[model samples]
Target: MNEEIELKELLQKNKMYQQVLDDIEIGIHVVNAEGKTIFYNKKMMEIESMEMEDVLEKNLLDVFSFAQNGYSTLLEALHKGSSIKNAKQTYYNNKGKEITTINNTFPIIDKGIQIGAVEIARDVTKYERLLRENLFKKGNTKYTFESIIGSSDKIQEVIDTSKRATRTNSSILIIGETGTGKELFAQSIHNGSNRMSKPLVSQNCAALPDSLIEGILFGTRVGAFTGAVERPGLFEQADGGTLLLDEINSMNPTLQAKLLRVIQEKTFRRIGDTKDREVDVRIIATINEDPIDAISKGRLRKDLFYRLSVVSIFIPPLKERKQDIEDLVQFFIDKYNHLFAMNVKSVSSEVWSMLLEYEWPGNVRELEHIIEGSMNLLEHEEILTYSFLPIQFRNKPQFQSERNTKKDLDEMLIQKGRNIKPLEEYMEEAETYYLKKALKHHEFNVTKAAKALGMSRQNLQYRIKKWKISKE
Candidate 1:
């Protein structure tokens, strides 16, 4: 019978079985229910630096002190009648070299009762080494323009234009809403330029006060001012490279004039010093505001705008390119899997639909944060559910609802005009018409409408509802 032959083969455990184990790439060990070592592959014996005779009658735990934890693990698995696989850890070899390995273990059952454990260990030293050497690994400084993840036509066009702009050393100005990855494009330009190997100093013009920003942009000379310390500014630090000026629209006009001079003449004077310092730092400035409006409002200078706009790169907002949402979700999920040490593998269709429908006013940064939050809240299962998303995303208002509300207001306005009560009444009707149009254009969101109209939300809402207009 097959059972008799199988039992005989298992009981024999002869030299042929040892030969098969020795030929495997992974290490293997077989122990009795009493945790005594009965069989070990050649690789395991070599790693332990022991001869077959020495290990023959010895308990595995007593022979190898490092394997005590493994014995506990085996006992737990045997008690539960379940297999424990892929227990990852780093172990020392015979030469005392650390090697990463994954242990795949199964219980040896007899007559439906758990007995001992057989463990197969596969070395993952090279895999871990490859993960370390990856350019996209955390804190790696090798990111270039190519790291921008998008295949949309608009994004590709922006990349092409940015590449052309980087080929020259001309000053570049990137304009986009917040969270639009302006700095990513700046880094790409720097890497594509001849200054790839040189330092790319970054300065946030809006994060510091005027005096501190000036000091950081232009170095201060020691002994030239009271308690002044000598140090090179960002311009000097980025000499022969690039200096990114983030939030350039928020910078004062005085600083704008000074920056314009540096870009035009390649020279700047440190604080409390008369002599000019020569530098070859390429300028890459970003602004969330429109340059024309910024210059008109006197927050920026026209000359500086002209100087920086010679090569302009504009990053489109996320809402305009709805096609990228799916890929971005997958990318963020993969990122969070490694970051959170999770097994989460898939997302639900309902979650994807909710993502596609929501108006991402905060752009890609917001999406990334949402994904991270979702991953943190998810349990051990491999699927991401709709409930994991933010409440606002799940309940996004439909476009038809918006249009229906707009039509209601338009009909009310026309009905008032048809009455022909007085010239003042016509004026009132026209004013309400335009006000409702403004609100509708801004998604009937009083906060956004108020901001666009330069009025408070309560004031705008009072006026609209006073006219008996329904937001729905």
Candidate 2:
């Protein structure tokens, strides 16, 4: 009698869940405590390449073929009454087609009794095949101004400035966090400018040692140093074009002085060579962090910064341009759909919510990666759902907003149920803390602290008195 009731409950569960599970992006398979298939969604059927009649009520081992004995994650979960997550499983289907999947399996327990197990599977066969082919190193380099993807006001501001900059050959500085597409803006400015026909050469300041870097920027004459060749540096090679100095803050201060002179004079001497060569190259530089912080740390020379920033363009981070996420998401989905030859329509509302809630520390690049990865795991479903998200996103809370994380601060602002403090009051308190730290770091030397903080000593003194900030 108990077995009959359990079977009835299983049938009801299969009917109730099939509609929801079949609509999700990943595959779903469920089995009974006795290892008999209880539910198989459409996605699972396509993933395993098996018929409904062939799987339902049939033993898992009898329906599927595994090269290794006792290798079924579903069977393990059912027997052990345990949960297995994010395990990569490889096996052949009923038709002998090799399949690769990332599986998350869990047991269903009723009171103290183990009833069955459910397994979620994501196919990664094509993604792994692409990795083995070594086809990722050479990416398409041609990026036009249209290639930039954003419609936010902050982004449009930079775009407008960059477009105006293309009309002039003045040195330009592009600033943003890493993965924020600094190179894209630089290439766009170059491609749009009159120097479009000329060659564009770029060198990373942080990729080599100081000694080797100088030689790289300014060509070395034969016998200039050990194994030195008669090679022309980036400046000579990029003559009449654009030369990109990437992460300029990482360049040595001395090298920066030489660079400043070259920008001012349009000439540079090769190492161990008596003669100087002239290049009419348009200079473009990028800083992967705040230029003000770079100056404070003495990583970038003040004079060099002043020169390079003649036409400054700042690319806002993903957080600062939340309005663009939807556009970028659709853009990448369209992009990967073409590359992977799949027809994924869109993400479900639940999945969409998580994308916006994410802080996006890696900015647009990180979003692109997450989207590409999710696309790789799609089954027969057209829309991406919660099931298709990465394990990190799946395991985390249901997308906490930035404001939600600072509830304590909000409470302090409304203590005793008083009206909240004005924005400037909070700003003043923050300034007070910052000034005190700077003063203490400089051992109460107001002049030095003011210089390091990029403010006039008199101005800092006035604020220090205004906030009553002191060593004590």
Candidate 3:
């Protein structure tokens, strides 16, 4: 009778433990030493699109055939008593819905004996979908000329020139500073071209090493090297279509020479192949710095520049297009309204004045981030006021400087019966003032603010925390 009572109490404790796991956000699954499903939480059921009745007391290999094939972390942990952390798992469920998750799996040991294995998973399907849409979707354009927000003459001229260039097959080079919407213009040109029905492939020249980039652009034949396999390169895949080369100035000189030959002859050979392969890909390259400066610095070759500059388009920085700031602000407001489910209608006059007066060194990208951050913090207000702006905007450098002039300080001191405070106190006040000013001037961007202040970013962050300064 005592044994039965103890067994019932242990079952109750296990039930309580399972209930606790179900209430948590992460998916959890526990398998016994024999690889049988012993416990599965509610979140696990939701993530896998399965039911409790289907998984309870069933062999994991029977439920997920991949387990028996030695492809599952739980099975591996069960057999090897090993732990796996942050391993990516992608699989298709019974209903044919693809699922992607990051998993941490480990063995459950009790008193020096391996009892079972448990797995914790976090879903990342949505993020993976967004990444695929951005990087690999063919014949799909996410932006066009209509999506370009500004109506300023400088932008309009570039748009017109880009549209004209799309009607031909000549090589085109785009020049602008960072955040000047280079990719946006490139995609627009691709969509507007006669080859819109074909694939539009793109690669960033600065994202990989020279060896990997060569293989990615020109492909490699089977047995080209120790581990190389036959593959189709971007030029061949984009045949009869368009290929966008972003940050072209970052390409090594040797790769640039090969690219020049491909552009001139419309043909390129695989890494280990002797015969040349023909392709009809129209090339569009982008540079975020001046071409002449790049040449002088040996980052780019003059011959390659001449070949790519058959037609060149320049995108003006946001500071030079101040007339478009108001429009761009309104556009971002509407965008966030839809994204964040807010109802912000307009900006206060003071907010507009401050926006116009500020020099947008980071250009349109920075403005978008500022508006998005402000909108995220807004609550129960229809109009965006000065208070809704970030603390950096509220404490601009010009206003702070005017408030700290010697004349104003002397008048304030005189009002205090000509009494002076301790030198330490005055020094602390000055330090606080300058730190805030530097942060505000950089719009609370830690790296840029640190660079402007001649300090490390970690040091700046420490001082900001010490001063109890709020970025929002």
Candidate 4:
């Protein structure tokens, strides 16, 4: 009976303990003072692609060659009886598949002396995938309620209201200035809503012609119109999903009535078809203009406005959300870093102050362009200075419409006997004028003219073809 009790205790401490390790999802392994793998779990076995018999008593470096750099670092940590957490690691298997992992290593202690070490690692492949989806996936329906990245209370209220309305299927209307990301809010509403699992189809009503818009919204029959190729409209395509009508105010009044009918009856008729099709698409419309004003201006129908105004959301302009500028700048910096394949580390404080002080009349889109242009113009520098920005922006213009004041410039040209000139002819004349000035500056040297104007030899040759100018 005593012998049986001793056997039970031994099994509980060793084999039973090993069974507990086997049950865990984390890869658990023990390494001796010499850095040989003394014991390993089933999880570790899978990671190393080795059997228990194959891995035991194997040197950590011999078993995993990629761990050579990490072995010395981990040994130092173990010698000091300290624990390392969340360390990044990568390994290549015999099949050459790269596996990324997050590691936690703790020094094993017995009798107040460091003996060896126990390491635990969790495979981060799925976590990395989720991160990628969150960052880049257009259809991702999951983001934090506060992730909309606006500081204005007006904008915050829109986010708050959207969150409250997520439990219902009420249609949303997001109003904002151009480039304010109205569709971004619409997507947030769809993702937050109960019907998140369904699709979200977007259409810019203004981008399509009136003839094509109706068929695009309602779909078409095999012979819907002259040379009518059958195609599904926004309603049918978004069935059991959400339909976003971007620039809704720009949609034709006739189509507006059809859309109102669909919203009211949840049914629509395909062009050249007698049958009405039922659909379950949630409607979200965005307009850059005020709906009340739009109705008064004959831009939108009052009845359609009332139907969409059930759940209205208004996004504030970028200037109002000034506090979010830094976060947004960082967000774009990280975004462009990967996109442009440059290692931009930071933006200078002076450049940031310049960004803050300037009134962003064009909002986030303008800021994004400024940053992108700066990245393109500058080399691989650690800091982005204000001087790196475009010359037009460095001098900075006061708040004014982006519309050309240069309409008079065209009129002036017409009055100067240039009215009948073709565009290419005008371009050729302009190029010749500039080329002559540059050549005078360079004493009519072709190489000098090319270098001074930042034009390549081949580009200069092409311009000369259009210029019809001779060096003689």
| TM-score of every model versus the real structure | 0.57, 0.56, 0.56, 0.56
Report, for every candidate in turn, its global Cα lDDT versus the true structure: 0.74, 0.80, 0.80, 0.73
After superposition, candidate 3 runs with Cα above 4 Å error: 1-141, 392-396, 399-472
Between prediction 1 and prediction 2, which has the larger lDDT?
Answer: 2
Global CA lDDT of candidate 4, please?
A: 0.73
* Model 1: per-residue Cα lDDT over 23-45, one tens digit each: 88777777777666677787766
RMSD, candidate 3, Å: 22.3
lDDT of 3 by residue, 273-357 (tens): 9989999999999999999999999998999999999999999998777656765776677677766777786676446556765
Task: Count clashing residue pairs per candidate.
Answer: 1, 0, 0, 0
The TM-score obtained by model 2 is 0.56
lDDT of 3 at 18: 73
Question: Per-residue lDDT of 265-366 in model 2, one digit per residue for the tens?
Answer: 999999999998888999999998889899999999999999999988889898877656765776677677767878776676456556765678899999
Clashing pairs in 4: none
Name the weakest run of 10 consecutive residues (lDDT summed) in model 3. Answer: 61-70
Candidate 4 per-residue lDDT over residues 1-472, each given as its tens digit: 9999999899779977888889999998788876677888999877656688766897554445332112333454565778989887655454333456788889988898777998888888567535644675455445546456543445667778888877787777888888888877777778887778887899998898997888888988888778887777888878887999999999989989989999999989989999988999899999998888999999999999999989888877877666557646655765677677776755664575467657787888888888888888878785788668877787665312211322444454455654566887665554576667667767777665654443334345445664676765
